[model samples]
Target: MAATQYMTDGQGPTISMLAAGDASDMLSGYTLIEHLAQNKTAKVAQIGKLVDEQAKAHDQAQQKITDLQKEIKDLASQKKRIEALVKKYKPQSPSVGMGGVTPRMANVKTVIDQEEGPFPTIGCVRHTGDPQDHGTGHACDFMVTTGGVMATGAAKAHGDATAAYAIAHASALGIKYIIWRQRIYDLRSPGWRMMENRGGVTANHYDHVHISVF
Candidate 1:
């Protein structure tokens, strides 16, 4: 009473018709496939479970990274706000006992150096031969860009901010006039007046913000 069976090599389950089973215990067709799949089912399931665990860990780590990045950005924003607040309400003291510069001009220089400046160059009390404000220690040139370069991008923006700040704080800083970007803002007139083109970056005050204090 012989029955059909399937034989296999070590590689995988393969069908080779062989008579090795009695009819009562024969494994063939659907029963044979079920028997073979059951042998490896536990191992396959274990490997899939490991893969799932690793994938979940990767996702968790990625979420943590994203959260930390957001935290850092938030902290940076808070720091900027705090710094701005400090600058806004901080009491300003005049530069005392300073020579070759007026007290008001020295205070302007001190404030700008502590805040917006550390500029490329700051020239004051220089010999202009015509007795302009520069020779009298009441003027300063806050050079935002050097090398006779016409300011663009960040330099131009910095110059604009410096000029605006000087204009805005003219009363407190005792600003007589501010010259920037070929225009002059005289506190007496309180208007921006265009000047004749001076043919160069330094001459036209394009690369520097000129401040003259009373």
Candidate 2:
């Protein structure tokens, strides 16, 4: 009769006969296959963890981009506000044939400059042969109409208020006289007086409020 031996199959507990050396080799091969399979499973798990970490990092990067865009928009809005303020307060250069503004005239000009109105321009001193307050750097002309034209209705009302304001603050501002709308307010007389028409708006002083300061 042939001799028989018992050994486990690699998959389960089924018994089979084999030479002793052959069984030992088969068992060693089975153990190596099992170890390889376990290693493959562990490698798959590590790859999955790495993929999850990469996905989390991608989400954080997108959030940072969104925050940076909002910051840029806010900075642009702030820049516009600063530019507007700069334009509003910027100093204007003197026009041709205009210079030599006095200290009192400059002070009064500062006050008028603070008023929110339709004052087109300021002309204080001029080079002329005529003996006028403007030629002596003691006067300022606040124009209401364009090209020395007559102002009407609302424009006239604005000019009236401007002239009145100059007269009202004359004592404090060292203003000697104000001429507007064919009338003159002399600080010496302290009243409005009608003037003879010199045949035009500029000559009659109807298009501007002329202030002479001490």
Candidate 3:
């Protein structure tokens, strides 16, 4: 039972207990007086050698246990990081009803959030007359950075990713066109073309991605 406990639970002994038992069994029949009377120096030397071997095996087992524990911890940390990424990229609901934007535009916002999202803000619908897409509730501005500031670093990367996603799924999302970083991808033309400079970052569509849906 003691040997079984050591092997199964790894908690009862130094794991060399089995070898010690075998050594004891080898000299079981001899009394203490008989052992002392007999010149059993060679036999005693063999038992000592057996003990040394068991000690080495025990040390090796302990080191293996330590290594396994560290591996388990590393795997757990990796799992946590993967879960965080999944949550960050998961699909989220867009404010479809709050803005006067069309359902197509709202669905596009949802798909972008699912693919490259969690944006700083999304603007749609304005009273600035002229009968444009925003005034007619057909356009949305997906902001990568807040307060109309120009995108940089991760924000710029995110805006680029959003524009790329829109271009890739333009047909499916019914996107008429997208403007970002002084460039435009028109569904009718089927290519990216540089838009004439419109002054600053906000005016030139560098601060946000503009999506117009049909």
Worst 10 residues of 2 by lDDT: 1-10
- Tens digits of per-residue lDDT for model 3, 114-208: 67777767778876643378887888888887666889999899989899899999999999999999999999998889999878888788889
Off by over 4 Å in 2: 1-98, 116-118, 129-131
- Ranking of all predicted structures according to lDDT, beginning with the best and ending with the worst: 1, 3, 2
User: Which scores higher on lDDT, 1 or 3?
Assistant: 1
As for candidate 2, its clashing pairs are none
lDDT of 3: 0.77
Q: List clash counts for every candidate, in order.
A: 0, 0, 0
TM-scores for candidates 1 onward, in order? 0.55, 0.54, 0.55
Local distance difference test scores for all models = 0.78, 0.74, 0.77
Every model's Cα RMSD, please?
A: 9.8, 15.1, 14.1
Q: State how far residue 16 of model 3 sits from its true place (Å).
A: 59
Tens digits of per-residue lDDT for model 1, 1-214: 0122223333222232233355433445436656756756878999999999999999999999999999999999999999988776665433222458888888888777567755876777777544389877898888888799989999999988998988898998789999999999999999999999878888989988889999
Once fitted onto the true fold, the runs of candidate 1 whose alpha carbons sit more than 4 angstroms away are 1-99, 129-131
Candidate 2 residue lDDT tens string, 91-166: 6423333467778887787676555243777777786644398887888778777786789887788788888788
